[model samples]
Target: MANLFQKIRKGLQLYQQIDMEALEKLAAKVDLNAVVQNVSKLDDTQLQGVMKLLSGSGGHKKKVPPPVDGDFYDLAELLTPEQRALQLKVRAFLETEVQPIVNEYWLRAEFPYELIPKLAALNICGVTYQGYGCPGLPNIMEGVLAMEMARIDASIATFFGVQSGLAMGSIYMLGSEEQKQQWLPAMQQMTCIGAFGLTEPEVGSGAAGGLTTTAKRTPEGWVLNGQKKWIGNATFADVIIIWARDVDDNNVKGFLVKKDNPGFQAIKMEDKMALRIVQNGLITLTNCQVAETDRLAKANSFKDTAEVLRMTRAGVAWEAVGCARGAYENALAYTTQRKQFGKPIAAFQLIQNHLVEMLSNLTAMQTMVFRLSQLQDEGRLTDEHASLAKVFCTLRTRDIVSRAREVMGGNGILLQYNVARFVADAEAIYSYEGTKEINSLIVGRAITGFSAFV
Candidate 1:
């Protein structure tokens, strides 16, 4: 009788283990007593296997996928702890402060003026320059920061590039000691914004010798007369680094053209499809007189101007990487979450292929820019090196952004999805700094020892 009681208790425990709903369906098909008799005849191993099948413990748990990240090779691991921290800090600031409002500003074709003080507080304006309130970090940091900013919004990246690289760089590389002391600190603090006036209305690719803006030396000062087109940040910049041809020597020189100059007028260029948030201006410098002392002290020729372009072009390559990264990441996330036929589109073979292609290009661009920055830091960077990176990265960025847009179908074109902005912005990046053909000729000239420019 005791043994019978123990068996009853064991049977009750096993009954509790069975799913009542599944048991009810089975009971409707088969006799409950017969099913129990068969289950009771099983050996311990067979009984445990039956229990395993019934419990739905197919031996292991489903594996969770790692988080989506564009840095496939873990490039961030290359930075020092402090450098990595700074990179994250800047990234956090951009994601929090800039990402939320970027689409609105880009749609309105306006700059967010309020971000200036906040961006300044980060103290990252003059990223690579030493002294004068600059961070004096390595060139890689500048490139990384550029990537981080562009990752969120290319317009903001371009704005910072104009202020830090083009304008401040012109002064730092060619300005007099007094000029650096006067402008560097203020610009670094974001109190005085700056603009770079290089590409004129008619002379972009041929700016080397075709600058129509003429500056004549006068007893009172220098008179700058001509027009500059596509001048970023020109609408409200405190100072404009106007590169003009010397009327007498026919050599290009740079000057500190103040915004308040009566002869200087900047009207915002309207209806830009790409990089609309950047306040590009049609600057008319009628008799824009700049003090002789305000002239870039060391800008003797166009070669000096090329120097600044060479340095900033590397940053542009990194910007391309950032743009590609943003698009690719957004697309990847979208594909995984957007369902079709009861499964993620990302699981589809064609979608996976597209993703692999994007990752392949993105990884290549990132590695290329990483080496490019290393060359800059080592002081071995040349125009060809920068142009090659700019060409390859921008071209691949165009491809990446295109593929990114393609994967999302109709939703890709929507600004709210974010891929559309990159698609438009990639066109601007591809053309600016230097066109693909121009950069190719630069590399062509370096490789073949011949001039391809007409």
Candidate 2:
């Protein structure tokens, strides 16, 4: 009983360290006699810990969270300082200029013409081309820039790919020096917009063997007839690179069909569920006359058209990465701040699992496309190489966006959330350029050395 009395005196002495007013408030809420009894039961080590905690010397410190970055492997460190700067510049432009109005324009299914001049000012168009006012940067820069653009808006990225990769690449690879001199500079400056016309209502994947659009040679030049569907930028493009079968030779040839041609007609495709900001057009040509001077000078067969597709397919893969990254980042930010059960949803085990899976896929895609661009820059890129990346990245992108939407619940479907846009646009990316089955077959053929593309 004497020892217990001494312990209680020590506990009372510790309580005296606190202000009188604080002790009074604590006494109101807690039974001081009970607390003193409990304190008296503690040994020396336990008493020291309690003293440290009460004095704010050993209490939990506010945690400093790491920044939310999706590049888990830091793949961007591979870029040159200049390239990194350019990438950040493009990202800033998209976030500041495009992000604010994209949902509005996307909702309206209308192109934002105001951004064209702003984009042109970046001087990134025809990024991989060497001459005629082109930037002549490494092909990896092209992939990186495509990612940055699509990270904010896939429609804008599609429009750019059509201009830089498909339209300019056709002329640069197949056109004569004179032809390149005439169009590339103007197109590079974005003063002259261009579109690519290859997919028809009846032909998409079968374009290698079957193009119904026919071009007949005449004294007046060439007369083009047939419909080209899903032509991006066609509604307002100054020039459309129309791939048509030569009537006499029965070979696929490319024509620079000017929008002003008598028979050239482009009608805006309405009510699209994806890529609505892109002014996709259904082009009708009733004897559309393209001058001989305007023909892609050296393009004589579908093999030539395949070259353009191979290059652009790699860009599509990067665009898919961008889409996935956007959705993952958005979902991650949402989870960290969005609370449930009196804590952040991100604190939950299942939410962290979803985020980890997304990061894994996104990291895989980023590294794959990085190497794919290296192959392109080295001149070793093949149809199979590009096809594989397109297949894997887009397929993974669909999964990531779906998971992103699922985590967000009903807000996932709302346009204000932004993941809804990625979910819809991913469907378009997966199907366009090449379907999942088509790209997979391309890879399968290369690996097994068997032509499975029947």
Candidate 3:
């Protein structure tokens, strides 16, 4: 009996590597002892029969399972048919084109310039605006578009947000008729990309009061002299809307500074751990001269800048929802396939609790943004309303993405899973439009009738 066992073990070892644990499981399903005894003394034909009994394949290859997805909550159904169609269109574009190449570009900290013309074909730029060859979609549609772009790649969404929401919005809301006519069409097509330079080197959350970028009237035009930091798309934009304090009136003014102006220079900000695909620029305006015609006529003070932010802040809240959704979906799918203790980890009660919590937060954010958009369409929205949504959604997104990383265990940090990118991007969203402290104060001031922001 011992000799028979030794012979059988040698034969199995010669054929292929055997995992003892897996072989033990297989051993339970068949009389391996008897089969080994029979095969040890058998000729080639008998051994072949014994092997055939163990092999499950009957002239068919094992089929691979289809990909698992994280959208288990069916949130996409909340979108209207038209909105859903647009969402899918952008999703397809991003999954096919952006997803495949995004990690490589992000690793190098470079923008995918080739996508500009491809994205221009989508005609989604300036989606919420009128004329200028834009689509004139509704405010809800704008939020959907932002969410769609962010679902695949937040850096691309940020680039789009700055161009369509902040830069073009400044012109649409505050520029002279001639200024709008000259810039909007070209910008809509991306023939001339635009950048919004509002945050200075020293002023971020307190930009409205602490901005040191100054503009002085000169015989030639306006001479802009200051430094702007964290200016997205500034490196390559054809025109940049620079917010500067007018020396005469101490009021913030917007100037459309052309890229080629001799005194204006933009250096790419490098070594960023978040949003690596975004090309943030550190801009220096040393007496950068601009034509008076380039001045935004209606943007008289910092109040005008706040108007642009209020419009985009709601979209940022929707973007937070997208980021959370992306992270939750990726983490949920991971737990399903990753096995532990002889079953999917997703089956564990703790994992289900985390997933349910993420979904609840996600649902709340979605519903809030939907109402916020309705208010915007009705022209009944207030700054506090938008601020509240932004604060809640972004705060919840930070929690969702962090939990997503935790649920994936070791693999969560990998870039290919897609959640890691969202995790990093969420940090930017948390503080960008306004910090939580600043946004909370906006809401507090409205509710308590006392300003809390110092």
Candidate 4:
């Protein structure tokens, strides 16, 4: 009885030292009775945490955005019924299969190998090539497919581009009948993955004028010695299309570099900020001997290489639009649902202005890429045309993603929100496949009737 009385006296003394006024103010801000009922169920540590949150001193996380429709321009109407069906099919597969695992794989900076066969099952590779188990569809369909892939994940779109556009396009355009017959069918089926080794450690926008990677003709075949950087899928691809400078003719040539060659090595690049899921490689070829039969028959000059770039640039433009569209849709969904001061922040005039600007840019980019693909279908596409689209679409994509990040506030930086990935990837798209400055120069030269590449 004496111990119980002493404990009660100590509790009374501690209660007298509490700040009742501050506690009352905090209690007035929320339902004090409900808070009491909830915290009553908590242990001592949890009750302390609850008090910290009530005082606004604890870590607060922003809410994530919900799933949203990205296509604001309704460009699907332009595609034929079959085309639209295929588009929807690809979109559904991406949303169902890829979306669930993308953030996880991207955070780990690793490729999702299990998805390759599933992508191949779609029968979309080599969409424009004839024969060889290819679809032989129009180029517009190719661009549309790229958009669909990128709308969900840019890294997957890049992997597909390396296979279907760069590697297969090289063989389809420049390889001999025997070479095409040997590789095209398996590649078209995605049974054999391929990569393109064109851009070297030191050569990029000025690749036409200079390439240090050399190929020498010998009795055994051609000996290739050079290094390639940023070769997508190189770490696992069965075959790599290597571009090298022929020492004898002083011309650029393409070679089929087998991944199993004793002299060929590909090291996976690590710690990339953008496109983390893409397995880019730094390849070194030392005395790599190849049979003459494996050399691209028609690729005797750099102009042949430019042809592949011109064809692929349109797809890159479409990818930019898709990335931008994705970010915009996510931002829109977040702003509509997220509240501020008892109202949705999107109701404000300033927020509406940002949203309107993003939509306007997105619509313009879609229409431009749509027409660009139509021109490609008509066989009227020039480097300047594709370059112009590349510059415009990628530039506008930066704007759209920026506004998207702005509207989402702090949640914009979190990968769970999706817009952060788009923002990081837009930087890569802006520079690869020709930088904005290089592409703009191509357009500037065409308009002024004078070359300004220097």
TM-score of 4: 0.85
Q: For every candidate structure, what is the RMSD over all alpha carbons to the true structure, in angstroms?
A: 3.8, 3.2, 7.7, 11.3
Better-scoring candidate (lDDT), 1 or 2:
1
Model 3 scores worst on lDDT over the 10 consecutive residues at: 57-66
Please write out the lDDT profile of model 2 over residues 1-454, one tens digit for every residue. Answer: 4564565577567767756677789799999889877977887777777767766777564444567788899998999999999999999999999999999999999999999999999999999999899999999999999999988889999999999999999999999999899999999999999999999999999998799999999998999999999999999999999999999999999999989998999999999999999999999999888899988888999999999999999999999999999899889888887889977788899989999999999999999999999999999999999999999999999999999998898899998888999999999999999899998998999999998877
lDDT of 4 at 437: 93
Candidate 1 lDDT over 1-454, as tens digits, reads 3454366457656776876677577779999789678877877677667667656785554434457799999998989999999999999999999999999999999999999999999999999999999999999999999999999999999999999999999999999999999999999999999999999899999999899999999999999999999999999999999999999999999999999987999999999999999999999999887898999999999999999999999999999999999999999999988889977888799999999999999999999999999989999999999999999999999999999999999999999999999999999999999999999999999999999799
In candidate 3, residue 154 scores what lDDT?
A: 81
Best-performing candidate as measured by TM-score: 2
Q: 281 in model 4: Cα distance from truth in Å?
A: 0.5
- lDDT assessment of candidate 2: 0.93
Candidate with the larger TM-score of 2 and 3:
2
Model 1 misplaced stretches (Cα beyond 4 Å): 1-63
Query: Model 4, 1-454: lDDT tens per residue?
Result: 3453354356545655686676567667998679546655776666667557755777664445445665576788999999999999999999999999999999999999999999999999999998999999989999998988888888999999999999999999999999999999999889999999988889988888788999999998999999999999999999999999999999999999999876899999998988888899999999998989989999999999999999999999999988888888888988988899977888788898999999999999999999999999999999999999999999999999999999999999999998899999888888889999999999999999999877
What does candidate 3's lDDT look like per residue over 1-454, in tens digits?
4654565578678654656677777788999879656667887666555556557543344444346443445656767798789888988998899989998898889999999999999888999899988899888888888877777778898999999999999999999989999999998998889999998888999988888999999888899999999999999999999999999999999999999987999999998888889999999999888989989999989999999999999999988887887888778778888889977888799998998888788878888888898899889889999999999999999999999998898788888787788888999989889999999999999999998778
Model 3 superposed RMSD (Cα): 7.7
Error of 4 at 83 (Å): 0.4
Candidates 1 and 4 compared by TM-score, better number: 1
TM-score of decoy 2? 0.92
Residue 171 in model 2: shift from native, Å? Answer: 1.0
